[model samples]
Target: MTSKHSLRNPKDMQYAFSYFYYLIHKKVPFDLDKLWAKEIDINRDGYLNENELRTLAINVFSTPLKPTTFKEFKSDLYKTCMELRHPTPAPVIVEESSSSDSSDSSSSSSESSEDSGSTAAVPVIPATQTATATAVATATATVTATTAPKATTPAVDNNTLEVGQKELEACRIDLEVLKASNKTLMEIHKSYAKRTMYRTSIEGTDEVAFLMVDDNDNSTQTKLDGVRQRRHKFICLNDNINHDKPTAHLVIKVIHDFYESLFPFPSSFELPPGQTNHFRYIHEIIDKKQEENNKNNTFIYIFGVVGVMIVMLMWKRSKRSSNGNHHSINGIIGGVGNKSAAKQRSNKRYMIV
Candidate 1:
């Protein structure tokens, strides 16, 4: 782990280790190009750490991985760790991230930049460990774990319980955060799809329609005839999109163009239930993209607030490591799911044991 010269990219080292972690702990993407895009940080002229990385594996992997894959991860785990300077003291979490970014001063626009404002969310350690450690270790670990909460039991160390509650609460909070992020993204997608819908009582003269429409709005029942030489409706999921969901809007736009070319006039294409309506779908995709852009701005703001929690977790984990407090999950937590909150609290009480 000791080397005289710093690796050309410490973050690369971090990324490599994180990549190894995914290779070990999580799934890996299949496409070589997509995998490379996920693996390398083209930002800061080099690499990036875990949070900012979009797991290629997560994107491409659809099902459970074979058990044997873990062996490969385990094999490379030590080398990658040594390269990354394993179990290195976690960083002190920083609450505020000023764009006075010394690191990536020369990157492209927010979209292209690797500074996606995501940092690793330290996973939740069960609360029981906090109880078993000595008061001194408990106090230090609390600082690393961070957050605000009260003691639940009298027999166990009150301070330990207080801190455990905090970290666990923080974990729960972060889960909410990730959930909110995904939810917002999905919402924007939906809204974008909706906005693309173009249902207007036109005198019927927009040339983009795939079918040539001959609708007369003045009539009691206008027959919206499409243009003669329109093309087939664009099939969305059929084609391979290079980028992630960000490109969904573009795909929608392409569909719009196809619809316009195909339907020459005012005729509406029949869409199956729960599928996209040509007009509304197109409108939604456009609005949703703008929303996505706005999210990038908001992400910075939201991340600024959470930065402190992330740093604190690192700091706390480091502090715990220094004192030789060890923790890992076991069956004492009871069956995986369906445990009542009370039971979970009790099981967590024994996590360290």
Candidate 2:
């Protein structure tokens, strides 16, 4: 490929490349062949040289080229090259100066008279060239102003901003509801913690009675009058209750309702022997499951320790074997050296004898 630095003008190359790109995408509004010939073939040679084509390929279309697309590009380029073999003639531009000649002559005469009276000399300029230069400068300035890129700030939509604010407000409302729910749950827990249960004898009767009291305040007390009355105590207390402002009575009622739902009161004031045994059975089952889990965990710990010990024993055995082999090799080498020295001394004594 030709180097980008070798190209005479990068702007012309970019423009020509844009035309080529438009042609490839089938977006050219004008004749592709005519545009390519006019813009790319700067010397009117009617042909794009290797250097020009390489510049277009490297600078303009510098992407990974697919084989099929590249083949299509080469085919279109070949057809355009064959069709535009002959150079077209340049258009002639004629400037008419006859209408302004009289005005120019009068102005020149006045300027000449002024120059003759003055001491300094001024250079004469052609009116026609000055007018042409002014028009060219104005056209260049207009084209530059139009083509130059403008710096723009991205616009933010008010509708999207409003939607975001609405979503944020909804999230805040949800957070408040969650906080209120948490506070209610905490109040329920505190009410349960302050409850007290005990058995007491009525003043004149031999019968014992159970009383459920709320220790949160001294105003509220609940008494189980008799065995028949125990069943409906929770129900009667929960009826006609207001929970919005949980006073001492309301708190006691809520706690009693929560406890009775889990464990209903027995028919007698004293708990039945069967019910007591059932509770003991449940506790024993939980303790047994917990003991089994602890045993399994202990077995796993011992097995891991044994595995580590076995590995360490194997490593020590291998190290001892290697050390024994190295010592044997050193001893064999030392014995061979001593044997050779003894043989050399015996030969030397025999030669002296």
Candidate 3:
């Protein structure tokens, strides 16, 4: 949870947590090293750089990562490696220089002195030089003491380095083996994905055949015959055809006969024919429903047309009745005017008489 690596992106933290969770609790059989080599190592380089690691997360772990997240992951991994190699001290102790380094320096100085004839005897000197001679003798003793621990220090360091290198090499070897195994497994998976007609596994070998025929095609029967003759250990027949095609019924019948020929007798636990006719019944029901829908649509169209015609007839009748009423009223007014004119003529004859 607490990491020295400063990850800027929160998604990166999530990615790390997901990966750690898988490492902690997943019980499924998976080869991480092999999956890494096969899927992530696109360039076939042994090292898993950031890009390769991203690929591994996406393909194997099913974890999608952004660029920033992957960068954080790289940094976190580096931090972990450093921590493993040299763990952080509980109580930090600052030192000006390391004792081992000082020891090494002193030892080198001593060796140089020995090479320059450090053991040569000192010449006899007067009492006046006695003080100086005493000082030189004291410095020599201090150097010898400092150089004493030098030998052990270099030896310890060499041993540690050697052990580390050996362990690293062993780890590399194990990683290579895992990669090889993963590659094999991936190949097996790919073969299965391709649906190979024949496949051989580590435990056993078997032959398989698959045929997908368009039921309406003329070559359907020929392909079925070939399948029957092959007699493979495994055979898969795919009925690929348009369900609404006119020849659908005939094709289904032929396929049914082919299956019946292959398996003449029913197994003891097999369902009865009537019980197994559920899909057929469903298809029949669907067909009847479709017919009903078509009939309903036809009736609706006819009713709409008849309704429009009736409305037009009613409108025409109303218009004709209004026009006839107007003409009859005009004729009655003209007849009244004609009778008044006759009365005026009779009055004019009486005046003349």
In the range 233-259, model 2's lDDT, one tens digit per residue, is 232231323445457465656456655
Estimate candidate 2's alpha-carbon lDDT, on a 0 to 1 scale. Answer: 0.49
Off by over 4 Å in 3: 1-92, 97-279
| Best-to-worst ranking by TM-score | 3, 2, 1
TM-score of each: 0.14, 0.21, 0.26
Taking the tens digit of each residue's C-alpha lDDT, what string does model 3 give over 1-353? 22544534544465555665655554434445554556656777665544555564454324555655544434434333434444444433334234444445555665666676847653434445555545555666666555443232121121112123333333332234333444434643443233333333432223556777685645777777776887666666765778888888777777777789889999997888778534445789798889999999999999999999999999999999999999999999999999999999999999999
Q: How close is candidate 1 to the true structure, as a TM-score?
A: 0.14
> Which window of 10 residues has the lowest lDDT sum in candidate 2?
170-179
Tens digits of per-residue lDDT for model 1, 1-353:
22344434343445445554544444222332332343433343233233222231122222363434322222232223222332234347533223223223222333343354455443433345333333444455566467422333212221212222333233322212322344333432343333222333323334333222212222211211222333223221223334355545655555455457555465455555478644446778788888999999999989987998899999999998866633333444444554677687888889967
| Candidates' C-alpha lDDT | 0.39, 0.49, 0.57
Off by over 4 Å in 2: 1-283
Off by over 4 Å in 1: 1-62, 83-220, 224-353
Clashes of 1: 45
Instruction: Score residue 218 of candidate 3 by CA lDDT.
Output: 57
